[model samples]
Target chain A: AQTVTQSQPEMSVQEAETVTLSCTYDTSESDYYLFWYKQPPSRQMILVIRQEAYKQQNATENRFSVNFQKAAKSFSLKISDSQLGDAAMYFCAYIGNSGYALNFGKGTSLLVTP
Target chain B: EAGVAQSPRYKIIEKRQSVAFWCNPISGHATLYWYQQILGQGPKLLIQFQNNGVVDDSQLPKDRFSAERLKGVDSTLKIQPAKLEDSAVYLCASSPLPVPVYEQYFGPGTRLTVT
Candidate 1:
């Protein structure tokens, strides 16, 4: 079974600053997908970013980017120019090419302050 | 486009009772998923459906939990004789069929409190 680990339980950042959340996973399959999901107080899980194991180039979206090091099984999310709205629970997830079910980490609570 | 929809944003029930949660996926989406999110933890996939047919339910406690997706659209999850430990948020997510780059969209979860 695949497992995702987010060592940090809580993280805080000031507005306009950059914060990085750490994530690592254990998987035998070489082809898989990694994702970062943000769940705000509304309880809606929104996709923040995604990284494909086959692609070495990291994925970036607006203020969100990921440092995906497949060789080390490390996939970290970096939030640039963090806004107050970025405060939420961030989850690291893994899904292999052969399955649709996502394996998730415990989560990291992010707090953004002005 | 409208994202996934889930009913009864909050529910409260005593132990030994039964409860059901409903979910409506995005239009034209071929995949639907149900997840259980315990407090302070990430959402855990309970079941996945591909057009009214189940694809995975390995982690689901079939002894007391059941779910079904009918007509390849709406889905329901039921917990019989709920346990105190069952208190958690039920999340619904949907996505198009597997492609090169497809993402799963989630709904506002239904928070269930079993007292």
Candidate 2:
């Protein structure tokens, strides 16, 4: 079974600053996908970014980027120039190439302060 | 395009009572998923459906839980004689394709409180 682990329970960053959230997973499958999702108080899970394990290059979307180290099974999300809207529960998820179901890690609550 | 839709937004029920939640996936989506998220924890996949057929229900407690995607568009999950442990948010998501190539759009979850 594949399991995702988010070590940080909570994180804080000043507005306009940068923060990195750590995530690691255990998987035997060579082909898989990693994702970061943000859930606001509204309870809607929004996709923040995603990375394909086979791709050596990391993935980035606007201010959100991932440092994906496939050999170490570590996928960390980096948020640059953080804003107040970045306050939310962030989850790291994993899904194998042959499977559709996502395995999510316990979220890390982020707080962006002015 | 509209995202996944789920209702009722909130539900309160006592132990031993039965409750049901509904979900409507985005049009043309070939896959839908149901997940249970306990407070302070990540969402756990309870079931997955490819159209109207069940693809996975390994984590779902079949003894008291039942789900159906009758028309391949709308789905319902029911809990009979609910337990206190069933208190959590139920999330519904849909993807145009079963592969991870397509993003899974999630709905505002239905929060269930079992007292």
Candidate 3:
């Protein structure tokens, strides 16, 4: 079984500043996928960014990026130029090739202060 | 162009009562998932289907919960005799089957409260 751990329960960042959320996972498989999802108060879950385990380079999507360390099983999210709209709950998830279900972390609430 | 669709945005039921939730995945998507999100926790997978076939259901509580995706389109999840612990936001997600990138498109979720 794979387990995702986000040590930080809550994180606050000033608008326009940068913030990094930590995540780590335990997986015996060599190839897998890592994802970051944002759930706002609207109750909608949105995909932030994703990283493939086989890729050495990190994944970037405009303001969101991920540092994926395959050997360490660590995948972290970095939000650059954080805005007020970034306030939401961020979750780290993992899914293996054998299945479609995701193993997710407890989630870290992000607060972007203006 | 529409995303995933879910019915009964909110549900309130008493314990020992049966309740069901419905989900309609995105068009052309062959995979669907049901998740339970607690108050302060991330969504937990309840069941997953790949075109009407059960792909993964290890975390699902089969004794009290049941789900079906007949004809591989829409899906329904039922909880027979609800429990307090079952109170949570139920989320549904879908993705194209056999796609190299298995990114899940999520729905707003159905909030269920068992009093």
Candidate 4:
């Protein structure tokens, strides 16, 4: 079984400040994918960013980027110029590239203070 | 272009009662999933299906929870003799067949409360 871990249970960041959420995984399979999902108060799981395990370059979407260290099995999410709307529960997930269901980490709640 | 749809946004029932939830995936999505999210925890996959055929159901509580996807499209999940522990948000998701690169689209979950 695969497991994803998010070290920070909760984090607070001032609006316009940058924040990074840490995530690590344990897996023997070399081929896998990583994702970060955001769930707001409405409880809808929304995709924030995704990273391919084979890609050396980090994946970025607008202000969202991933620091994916494949050798170390660490994938962290960085939110730049954080806004109050970014405040939500974030989860890191893993899936085998070949075929497998996603394994999710215990989420980290992010609070953006004005 | 539509997202996954789920019914019964909220449900409240007494312990040992029976309840059911429904889900409708995107038009062409062949893979559908059901997940459970407890308070302050990550979503856990309860069951996964590929075109009406179950691909995985390792974590689902077979004793009380049952699910079916008759036409490889819309699906339903049921829990009989509900327990207090069954109180959680049930999420439905769907993705295209095969590739892991395909993102799974989720629906606003159904909140089940067993009192």
Query: What TM-scores do the predictions have?
Result: 0.97, 0.98, 0.96, 0.97
lDDT of 2 at A55: 94
Worst 10 residues of 3 chain B by lDDT: B96-105
Q: List the residue pairs that clash in candidate 3.
A: none
Say which candidate scores most in DockQ: 2
Model 2 residue B49 lDDT? 95
lDDT of each: 0.92, 0.95, 0.91, 0.93
Candidate 2 per-residue C-alpha lDDT over A52-110 given as tens digits, one digit per residue, 9 for 90 to 100 = 98999999999999999998999999999999999999999999999869999999999
Per-residue C-alpha lDDT of model 4 across residues B1-115, encoded as one tens digit per residue: 8889999999999999999999999999999999999987899999999999999999999999999999999999999989999999999999997437788999999999999
Off by over 4 Å in 4: none
Q: Give candidate 1 regions above 4 Å deviation.
A: B98-100
Q: Report clash pairs, candidate 4.
A: none
| lDDT digits (tens) for residues B37-104 of candidate 1 | 99888889899888999888998999999999889999999999899999999999998975226888
User: Which consecutive 10 residues in model 1 chain A have the weakest lDDT in total?
Assistant: A39-48
In model 1, what lDDT does residue A90 have? 96
* Model 1, C-alpha of B94: deviation from truth (Å): 0.7
Cα-based lDDT at residue A103, candidate 4: 87
Per-prediction RMSD in angstroms?
1.2, 0.8, 1.3, 1.1
Q: Give me candidate 3's TM-score against the actual structure.
A: 0.96
